[model samples]
Target: MDNITNEEKQQSIEAFQSVIRKSENALASMKSGSAQSRLLEKRLKAARIGEGLLAARWEGKELDVSHDELVEAKQVLEGLLLMLPGFLEKTKPGSGQRTYIERRIKAFQMAVSYLNE
Candidate 1:
């Protein structure tokens, strides 16, 4: 994503919007206290952050994220980092899923570092 062209970033922003809408719809259908709803909420938040990141990039500027939002994103991503290793271990070595998980881990680490800064 760091190397994506402007056109690609625009597409990513659109994709993130779609995810946010769908996640919102799904969240509406779930029980308020259900684990699924909680997970969906997190997904929605992540999509929003991703979209904002892309939008800022498109505008040729740094993201103007709020302190609280950055903290929330960092917490969510750190939680995901804790869980991803289990899934990564289950995938076969050299598999596409494995590679994807690896990349995702790296991306999350980078995001956490950026947020910290």
Candidate 2:
């Protein structure tokens, strides 16, 4: 594989920073009871699980064998991605919370794409 260029590395770093900012903002914005808030929580959980799986794969930890398991993971990720647009559309911008949720959802979508590849 070709080495990542300096510009590419910088972009990657910036993207990661953006995701962190977004997550922080989303957490701050969450309320105790609201549909949007609930959806955001659910999406965040899904993203975390996806991140865990990806991290495990990167660390060369072999997951237990099962065709059904792989299929379920993919299906769930896809379903979460599909739910993003609706959640994003409904969320209001208060204290920059919506922006953060949007960023996280986008990040999760990108992760799903990477996994598919």
Q: Which candidate has the highest lDDT of all?
A: 1
Q: Could you estimate the TM-score for every candidate?
A: 0.64, 0.46
Report residue 60 deviation for candidate 1 (angstroms).
Answer: 4.1
Candidate 1 segments exceeding 4 Å error: 1-33, 54-60
lDDT tens readout by residue for model 1, 3-117: 6566554545555566678889999899998989988898679767866765665577787778788788778877877998999989999998786677666556555655666
Per-residue alpha-carbon lDDT of model 2 for 1-117, expressed as tens digits?
124455543443344455445665787777856887665555455445555544444456854535554555556657866876887787786746576556556545555665565
Q: In model 2, how large is the Cα lDDT of residue 17?
A: 55
Q: By TM-score, how accurate is candidate 1? A: 0.64
Best by TM-score: 1
Q: Cα lDDT for residue 71, model 1?
A: 81
Clashes of each: 0, 0
- Candidate 1 has which clashing residue pairs, if any? none
